[model samples]
Target: MIFFDTIGTMAIGSRLRMLSERITEDARQVYELYGVGLKPKWFPVFYVLSQNNEKSITEIAKEIGHSHPSVSKIVREMSKDGIISEEKDKNDGRKNNIKLTSKGKSLALKMENQCFDVKSAVDDILVQTKHNMWNAIGEFEFLLDDKSLLKRVIEQKKKRESYNVEIIPYEEKYKQTFRQLNEEWINHYFKMEEADRKALEHPKEYILDKGGHILIALYKNKAVGVCALIKMNESEYDFELAKMAVSSEAKGKGIGWVLGKAIIEKSRSLNAKKIYLESNTVLTPAINLYQKLGFKKIVGHPTPYERCNIQMELNLG
Candidate 1:
């Protein structure tokens, strides 16, 4: 019985893999009956080499639609079994060329049209279905040239995950998100003091109203991360990059990277000269990211937050 058989089309991939495995095993049985020591997986490589004279490993691999490593492994096994010969190319000694041995050549001649036999059987069975399996497979292969099935599937998943995340300007609704995201980290490692509360509670009055910019990261239209660039030193176009956080549940989806880029772009747009950030040594992941984005550790900078230990600055000039 097929597990998940009820899912039908949703389980096509598993069904295809299972079907391939079953057909491959049956082909192995056919080879045994013919007294040919061959595995279905080795068919492509062996058949390609049989048709070509002393082809290089890479040439055979590409023609057979297998990786060089996979072809190499099969070649090694075939060479050990005395069915194929491997040697340095006559013209280019650096390249390894492969060819069917006398034994392999004999089998190839005997097995001529044998590969077609299995296909013909499958085709006969598929005749009962309204759909043409060969034509469908050919179309599927054509589509694969544009994009592999695995790649398209992975990209779709990433798109779905990314669709849930969006970075936007600060709003009244997100005042609490900024507080909760930041507080989650602060409360875990250090106590939230008066300075933290004042900024978190009255962001519009204290931060945004002072020509500062704040950004919020939304996941499914809900705030999950937040960061602020507070304008500083009236004469100097310096901005303090502070109060950045990604929610515990939303961490590690490149959300922190997205927020950092947004803040940097906003600071640049505001004609800022430099961005300084203060953090603790324990937040290594955040620090590493900051460093990757050209933030350098600097000494002698004073910070009001008691929890702050490490100071880093990014020169936008």
Candidate 2:
């Protein structure tokens, strides 16, 4: 019986491997149609260029975890193909800077589109092959590892029990809690004068009067996190998911992601065309979570919130 079970498992694994190879081949064909010569090895070069422009060969090599000689050879081939250009750095004569050419930029865009299509196709296939298999696999991996998934589940349960938070439209009673939470955030990170803190804590009456709504996350009937959605104009929506403060006692309880998802759902329900947020780069975990949730980085805006070093945006409509 054990031998038969082992043989069946091996057969299933072999079939899955063959299917994956077929998917890869299909993806390559799609790339070729776009006139882009994409290969597994060339990905490192593109990944470095995507992050920052005009990086030195040494910097690119370091970022991609390749030896300098290997990267130099690849760059030489890429340059000969008219995909990248190399120039001597003016300030550092010994260093060579690599920049993507027009062809390279076009290829990058095409590759992105093709990759998205391939992902969609694979997702559809998996959905059809076995219902809820992805979720089951994810849970299995979580269990096999350091029990991270189980830990997250336990944390979520605790949060649910302690918070029992409800999402509601802006109300006068929430103003005091919002102010208090905002102050707590400022104190936790930014050192500001009493008057300055008070100024920020003072809710903008104009925003409230102009059809703005706030969502507060509460624990034991005490406000813990807050997000605001403001109508920018007749046809536009602006969101300030700020004042998102979780009580120190409730830290590491997955409250942030929950609140973030709730805020996004609320924004969509309100027919928001776009949602914008201001944050600091020092909070890497928060930034990563935002990225995972489909937020994209944007330039800093001219706003009164000077402490907000990072800006992110999401398009709903």
Candidate 3:
């Protein structure tokens, strides 16, 4: 139960397996009591071929949503037991069609009558559990067939990373976070200049004391990103939006977007009429975020940092 609760959604495979194992184990015991030799797993292929009379290994696998090798292995065991046989297709020499032997036919007929008991037992369990297990399984299979489990898992990962990110005001505890997150991006793409170091090493002295605001993005209670709006002039609510960085582990999760939005809203609250920023053209994603927030390219007189080739501004009325 602890494992079930702990694993949660991760327990899908195990839970499904347990359901099958429990029911199959009971059915196996039932078969033993009835003195039947067939296994529960063999029913799908055997039952399908009984109706069709002749189906290739590939056809059996496709009918049951099982792999060809798995169907072939079952066919081999059935052949060994003298319960089924294969014949080369007259139209295609490479293809072999499967057929039920006399023994297999006899067993299918006898078990067909007893299958009602198995169905009733399963239905009883479903009733007790307050679930229609057959319908549930059918819907689950239909869902997976419509969109494969792998594609669904991939989309979930991307959505989880990008959609739910949150940004919060910076605190004294996030001193290292501001520095580390910035340093990671700066040092990786370009060398940390003296201007960058002065701000990174002492974020409070360089940014906060200078009438600027710093913001951080948190994912699962951990600060994974930082951004700042540096006040440019003593006269007006003009600010320079800079020092934005998202940790490598949190890059694709839209942390930058969250942090940037927090900075924009903070500037608006501070009566910021205009916001300016400096960046390199190489940082396309970062630039795109600015554009999304109505920041457009503009020519500025001068900049303190050497790496600042492209300048952008947002006019907030």
| TM-scores, each model vs. reference | 0.56, 0.48, 0.53
Q: Which pairs clash in model 1?
A: none
In candidate 1, what are the lDDT values of residues 199-241, reduced to their tens digit? 8989988788988889998888878889998877653438888
Stretches of candidate 3 exceeding 4 Å from the true structure: 1-9, 148-317
Q: Which stretches of candidate 1 lie over 4 Å from their true place?
A: 141-222, 226-317
Q: Which candidate is the best by TM-score?
A: 1
List, residue by residue over 158-225, the lDDT tens digit for candidate 3: 56775666677778899988998888888878888998988888888998998888888878878888
By lDDT, rank the candidates, best first: 3, 1, 2
Q: How accurate is candidate 2 locally (lDDT)?
A: 0.72
**Which residue segments of model 2 deviate by more than 4 Å?**
1-163, 192-201, 233-237
